[model samples]
Target: MSHSQPDTISAALARGRLGISSVVSFVIAAAAPLTVVAGGATTGYAVTGVTGIPLAYLVVAVVLALFAVGYVAMSRRIINAGAFYTYVSRGLGRPAGAGAAMVALLAYNAMQIGLYGGAGAVLAQFLDGYGVDAPWWVWALVAWAVVAVLGVLRIDLNGRVLAVVLIAECVVALVFDAVMVSHPADGGVSFDTLAPSHVFAAGIGAALVTAITGFVGFEGTVVFSEETRDPRRTIAWATYIALAVTGLLYGFSAWAMSVATGPDRIVEAARADGTDLIFTLVSPHLTDSVITVARVLFITSLFAALLSFHHTVARYLFALGRERVLPPAFGRTSRRTGAPKIGSLVQSGLAAAVLIAYALAEADPIVHLFFWVTVTGGLGVLILMTLTSVAVVGFFARIVHAEGLWRSTIAPNVAAVALGGILAITLGEFDTLLGVAPDSPLRWAFPASYGVAGLLGIVWALILRATRPHVYDAIGLGADRDTTALRTPDLVRHPA
Candidate 1:
């Protein structure tokens, strides 16, 4: 391929097809509000033994918003689909950045594969209602096929589908909240759930971590910056919009559920009906039709989440490949669709392999595949966020930006400290979160794997620096080369 031809292919990502709203839609869909409210809220109540789950969501929102201060600040100056990988490289150097890149790939891929488990389990349940019998992995494979198709299409098309699902998810959640408020139980719409003492009471650490998990996709807004219109403003606005919308929706629904069950009895109620808590509460206030619709939407919620993560993971792989950190072929884009076709296929294949492995092993899809993988994925993401926060401070500290102190220094440092604390708490309480024995191998394996992956990335980066200086220079393509050009550092060495 000629140099310009390769550069043209590298830069192809269906640019200008997405705006702020589209970016928000993708991020919000990734969060999957309906799934969180239906299942996650119940888990939060059971684990925390507190009525202040809403307050926990608010706390996480605030912490992440602070993190976004520096994140968006950097996004404006450095545009790349690599996200944390690119940010860390520019701020922390190529080796550390490469480590972050590998960790991100693991974190996002885990989340995507984990969603397949959840989707398959839920689809089987839906099918069971109609007397259609099949293994959960069968349903999982079907959804995997759908996501693979969408992942290789133009992103704007995917954004449209996600927007529809996201809007429906929000509507159902809001209606449920309204029903709870109108039919408040003995507690009568109490404000006690918002109390600091209540929020920080027993099991607060677990509650806070779960709440943090709910906001995972907010920071992902910048991943689409390359395709978005007016990226600087669009990325910033989308971040704030996604965070505020997700926080309010989650907080309102959780607090309302507590009121529906009576604050003091919410934990017991959630324990009795863990997965069906939301449906159970809503069914009483609405007609049977509403219940059926909610059930169908619940499955769609999982599908939307799976699809959203599929695109994110594909882009991460594409960015790494473009940098020559992975096989160069993985960087190839489709000329017609301007999609990262190879990366998308790779992600789909990986998901298929994992699904097949779980099926052959006869693993419990929900527990072993969904719960175990997502919790581990969430931990990896938290670690990545923490590192990115540190990189933000490092990046800005050395540069001669005229930005304010808060965005450049204080907010990133504070976010780093806050995330570090959360990461520690999560590790300490890992077994509790996974409902496993204290000595379980899973308790150690997940965190250890991420550590090993990061180390390997660092080692590979060092080797590249020593033996392939040209490739090393292109690791992140530096700040001078417009990331939009999509040319990797190694591309310079093999110019046609």
Candidate 2:
């Protein structure tokens, strides 16, 4: 853990790309297709029954909106590339901070690599219906290659591409939802769908889980906190606006889907259509050309989402390296592109390793690799959010004018409590969540990951303290630390 500062960490502050705007920022944040394919309303209906799903969206949106209060409040104060980890480090201490950062890297990397399986399956089905035969992994590898290119490219270019895919697909989704509202289908547009009665229905916890996933890539906007026009204003506004906009899109679309099909029947329909039921439901509702366009948008959205996740992983690595936890090289951004080149390569290598392992095992990419990995990402994110909430409390503990204790401190704190309970339920229901048996491999893989990451982090901290106190001092604490190794009071924390 103790190595002299490598040349990489000493590099000048990155004038990161201004590639992202509030518009594109929001799109990439909200419109990731994998989560939506579970269908916009799918979570609502399944969790609270068709009736309660909309309410779940309202509930999560409002609750997390509370969390965003602290998130944005802190962002205005402290702007940095590292998201939750940075905030935790500032408030909680460097060791906890380093632990969170490395684990987040593990979690997000799992998500990006998981996308390959999902992309492969979707592409395979698209081709198979036309008799252009190939296994899902072929398409998955093709996707992996394309996203790898996007990940290493300059940030502006990547933003533009993501904006296009997200906008087009999201617009198509909205148009169909509009149609569904007017069409009088079972789950379509009824006031009853939004009722509180439905919110408390059968699978409320499950619905909350699904709704939360769509919000996954949203936090990533802060990954480019250093590169944005005004880190303070840009980062805070993006988080709030993105969450508000994404919440509306997801909630409204769910309501519309219910209206398109009767609420009672939408579940049965989804059983047949699966997550893509909304896409297929509206296929016959739209012209052939429009259907093709939506289909194409679907694939590209998946790719854009993958690249978004990939960049997040790189940033996490960059944060760790910059902080001197991992090799300092991971902290380095390419002088040429202003992207985290070293970290990007390391992330891609790890992903390639996982993909190869899955391929070698003849595993079902979507079922095994994608599903398991994404779930791990889900768990990790939940944990980060919870810990980060505690960090928020610690942060406001020292602030003079309590501008948003309720939003940042109380609300998010409450959300974190709810999230903890949900995560516990998720752990217990892993078998049900993954549609596997009690003794399924997934049972071991899921919870085992949490334990493994925790142990490694604890060990790393001990090693740093014993062998590399200097580096350990920098672990969760920021460079804002004086030589005394405590973060300066004026230093701001990032929200998760």
Each candidate: RMSD to true structure?
3.8, 3.9
Off by over 4 Å in 1: 1-11, 47-52, 478-496
Overall lDDT per candidate, in order of appearance? 0.82, 0.67
Q: What is the C-alpha local distance difference test score of candidate 1?
A: 0.82
Clashing residue pairs in candidate 1 (N, C-alpha, C atoms within 3 angstroms): 474-489
Clashes of 1: 1
> Which residue runs of candidate 2 sit more than 4 Å off their true CA positions?
1-13, 19-53, 129-131, 186-193, 399-404, 438-441, 477-487, 491-496
* Best prediction by TM-score: 1
Model 1, 229: alpha-carbon shift in Å?
1.7
lDDT of 2 by residue, 5-40 (tens): 443333323554563364345335334743464433
Name the 10 consecutive residues with the lowest summed lDDT in model 2. 487-496
Per-residue lDDT tens digits for candidate 1, residues 113-138, read 98788889888988998999998999
TM-score of each: 0.93, 0.88
